[model samples]
Target chain A: MFDLSTPQRQSKKVIALYAFKSLRGFIFFFVFAAFGMRGFLEGLAFTGLVLFVAATSLIGPVIQYLFFKFHIEQDEFILNKGWLFKEKKAVPLERIQSVNLEQNLLQRILKVYSVQIETAGSKEKELEIKALDESAALSLKQALLDISNQREEQEKTEVTEPEKKTVNPTSNEVSSTLLKLSFLDLFKVGMTQNHLRSGGVAIGLVVGSYFKFQDVIKQFFGDYLDGWEWENLMSFASLGMLFSFLLIFLVFSIVVSLITVFSNYYGFKAVVYQSHLELSMGLIKRQEIRVPIEKIQSLEFRTNPLRQWLGYSTAYIYQAQSDANKASKVSIPACKKEHIKILQETAFKDSVVDATIDIPCNGFSYMRLASYIMLATLIPTLVPLAYFGDYNWVVPMLIPAVVIVFWSYMYGSNSGIVTDKGFIGFKKGWLFKSFSISPVFKAQAVEKWDSIFIRRREEMHVKFHTASGSNGLRYFKKDAVNHLLNYINNTVIKSNRNWM
Target chain B: MTNEQILTHSLPDIESFSFEKHPKRFLNKKLIANTLYMIPLAIAVGFLFYNFSEFPWLGWSGLGLWAFILLFSLFVNYKEYFVRGYTLREHDITYRKGWIFHHQITVPFNRIQHTEINHGPIDRLFNLCELEIYTAGGSSSDLSISGLDPKDAQNLKSFVAGKTSTHV
Candidate 1:
């Protein structure tokens, strides 16, 4: 059933997105070619032959404009249409946690933006509204603010209408704070992020696969090798392997550098609206990411070794938006260090806290880290050696195992948590650090855990869980972790404000 | 902090939970509780009843287990009704379970989302009900407060709700 689409707008600009439009058609054409069902495309071809219609008109853009329709609602944003069925949802403003706006090269050319409203759940309750001119999209943010203000009024009234102290609810708006990343800030971010490792891994896989495929050709198509001693070539295979490894590591690092330079430096701009923070960047596939002021679990200005040396810092926010298996990582494609603290202070404008949280790691972290990392190397060696008795993969694996052990040491050494006047920060990881955060009142569950192993060593793990995210300190001296946990727990409990 | 200062600074005074609201014979002695645990032996008895003609030995063992369980339950119930006592701290609600394990969980009032008081058919006959508390992070962390009086359970619900992050 299709309901009528109702939209509120600051202006009359809508984005018609063909997210996978060309790909969808291409796939359908190729897949249907097996059964000789290329009717529509062939028909178009035949008509082209008959009419000789060359560049008569470009109707693709005209046709796409007719396919999509969306508009903002009072408390939510709405989209209506269906090649099959139209679905409409009443997303209350209070339920929405964040709104992200993205723009690509095409959108930038059109001077438009795509807005996404993320609600509180796993169901992807995001209303991805695209094709709005930048100014129209900017003004649309006011609608979101208006609704959030209404939700606050409702909460206050739901508690005690008669006890209302404020006469005007709408007058007090959450002031917006904007953070911008500079070239050096972005450069430092590129260096500190896991972007390099992943790029290296991808290069390895591609080169490794290319070599393996060529080797397969030599085996099955020996004549193609042209009397090249194919049968006795197993010994010299290590040359190919070594060369591939070097190529991956080198090419990957270069690519990583290029990506970092391009992504962070292109067109980065972060703006603070009344209730939301929006960031837009990307030279090619431009993107805009937004965060609600309330859902921001932790925000910080971080300086890694390289960044510290360069005298620049990166700003990031660690929000809770993931399953327990995969916590939401910080996003700082690139930014100057000064912007991070500015974002933190300005994001919570009226909050009383003017402090920070500190994280400390003990020697046990190294032990814990090593044990987890060893699994990567140990399992492959033992399994293949036991089952297939193959030394090819096992010998190659030790290199990765050694590298992992070194990285684990770095990770364990760097992890720490800090608590200052009103703010608390828990920093963990070395290669890619994740600093989880919270206002003191958000601690949902506090526990001091000591295992049989830890008890003997006089060590402990203290954790404080929050609604969407958790901030924890592990492998600390038992008393210190306990005191911190107790203090935070008591601090959260004593506050009259409710945290959800 | 001084005692008086601590009192003023601590969390809200969430009271109203009392022992009079728990089920009769809620707690039990160690030996009697262990013996009463044999009630699940009735499942084995049911298996025996169906094949009693084929396995007469199993039928006899099942009956012996059932008799032991019934007598032990009566003894256990007597001790539990008289021996156990519980206390509620100002900000937290504590539940003490077992004669042997002797462990207690103190749940702070603000952290509790909602409490559900449910009674099984058999529990109804024994005037026993279980109060289940659900917290925010999914389903697994739910706390079950077993063996509480129905009336006190209602009062505890309101008292805890007053301190909850959400009103309803």
Candidate 2:
């Protein structure tokens, strides 16, 4: 057992990990030294700079590792670090949301794990132990969890009856493996991954790097680039070239998607304890995340047409919003329909299973489509009139107008709302569909909005705000909106359960 | 109650609540604040008019547009003052605002993370305070009730704090 009550530093190997991290920051300096410097004097200066970088990178991590110490005392987890400006943090045990373990390539090579202690507070306020052996990390996680549970029980007893102390039952808590992805399942997930998003990311990376490396390219081949004829090169480009280029991009994106899928979900597994769910995955940068069931504000399931046909979807578990990390939501990729059902049932025990979309916002859809079409038409018509002073450009703009109308129609038709006694769900999207479900009691606020036009049409928009985020129905009948608002409000007021 | 009963039960209608308007002096405060902004804008327009004296039509149109905007804003502020009202219920508080686009938000006391009473320089001069209620749902879901009497703000803050503690 790990003695967590006494202050301790991470494993000695953490110094090397820290050095590597700090050295990564000096990459720009290395690049500049390699390409920007010339002459013996400049070369000597570059050598000095390199020596300075090496010394600082080596010495900084040593100091950081030496100064860092953490221990649990009373009901607080205290951490002390920083060399020049001494810093200390003490987070109450009850406020800790989860204790995750992650192992990147470097850490894996060093045979050490990093522990991330997440609190219900802002992300910056959380704690991280850069390197700890597997057993040490596991024991520390358990110690923190056990103490937090004890603190909660103590608080409950104090609140209910000062004399009646409850015994901790964490030792006998049931743990079950919820889901595990097989090799074939992983392959299917990779094959059905969103290629479009991968393609967009790949293109973005290429464009961004091109701009980043533009100065370096100009320095090396400035004369050659200046003498080149860009107009002549464009004259040689044809429809066939464009088609071939598109095909290449498509193939590249699919490869990237497959690689990402294999690396991220290689050994995906989910395990659920009585109070929290744990997910561990990744081949290169292994990560394990744990979230208390109570803190989960909403659950979202997303799938494309292909994934839906393949009988799997990605589920996102949204907890209380941490100000520092907006993308703190945990996602489980390649969850079959049954898996999603199990997750939903686990997160919200009282929620109805397989609740269909009961309220369709068709009026809202029609209104959105109509307004989009009007805006599209108006923009094309007015822009050409203002710039060209003619209707000639409007002919070519008709193609985009038709595309917009079709997209808007599809989006509108696919959007809907699901309302049950204990749950509220919002479903939307055309090609990439997403459905999010949250308990009614989890709502922090309810908002009703009505523009003059919407009011004239006797329709309104209703939003349900949860701790994680907000979801709502748009362009619903006034009466329905009002009923939902009232229903949610009443449920929230009457329910004794905590939102988080 | 059964789930069916909970669904069918007639709860107090939020629409029927008789919302209370802010103090009449608060309207004067809003007008003064608007004037402070309008004065600088008017001066900028005047500077432009002087600089562009060669085009008499341009200066005249600029001045006309400024006048129209000034009048429009003043009218909107007045209308919005009436439309903006808040209703405190047994379990929740509702605030409605806007003239053209009506927005009403209801935050249950139990869901409130914390309550703060803010008294700015202008608010101090008017003996008014702004009661801000925050939730874990982030800033967008927070509620700020401005132009509240200082004593009333304190009472509401304490009441909300008490409610949040007990409910949780």
Q: Pick the candidate with the highest DockQ.
A: 2
lDDT, candidate 1, A228-283, per-residue tens: 67566766679778899778776667567657656645667777765456776777
Clash counts for the predictions, in order? 20, 0
Per residue, candidate 2 scores C-alpha lDDT tens digits across B70-103 of: 8888888888888788877777888988877888
Return the number of clashes found in candidate 1.
20
Error of 1 at A105 (Å): 4.7
Give candidate 1's error at residue B43 in angstroms.
21
lDDT of each: 0.57, 0.82
iRMS values in order, in angstroms? 6.6, 4.2
* Residue A146 error, candidate 2, Å: 1.2
Residue A150 in candidate 2, Cα distance off native in Å: 3.1
For model 1, the docking class works out as incorrect
Model 2 error, position A176 (Å):
2.9
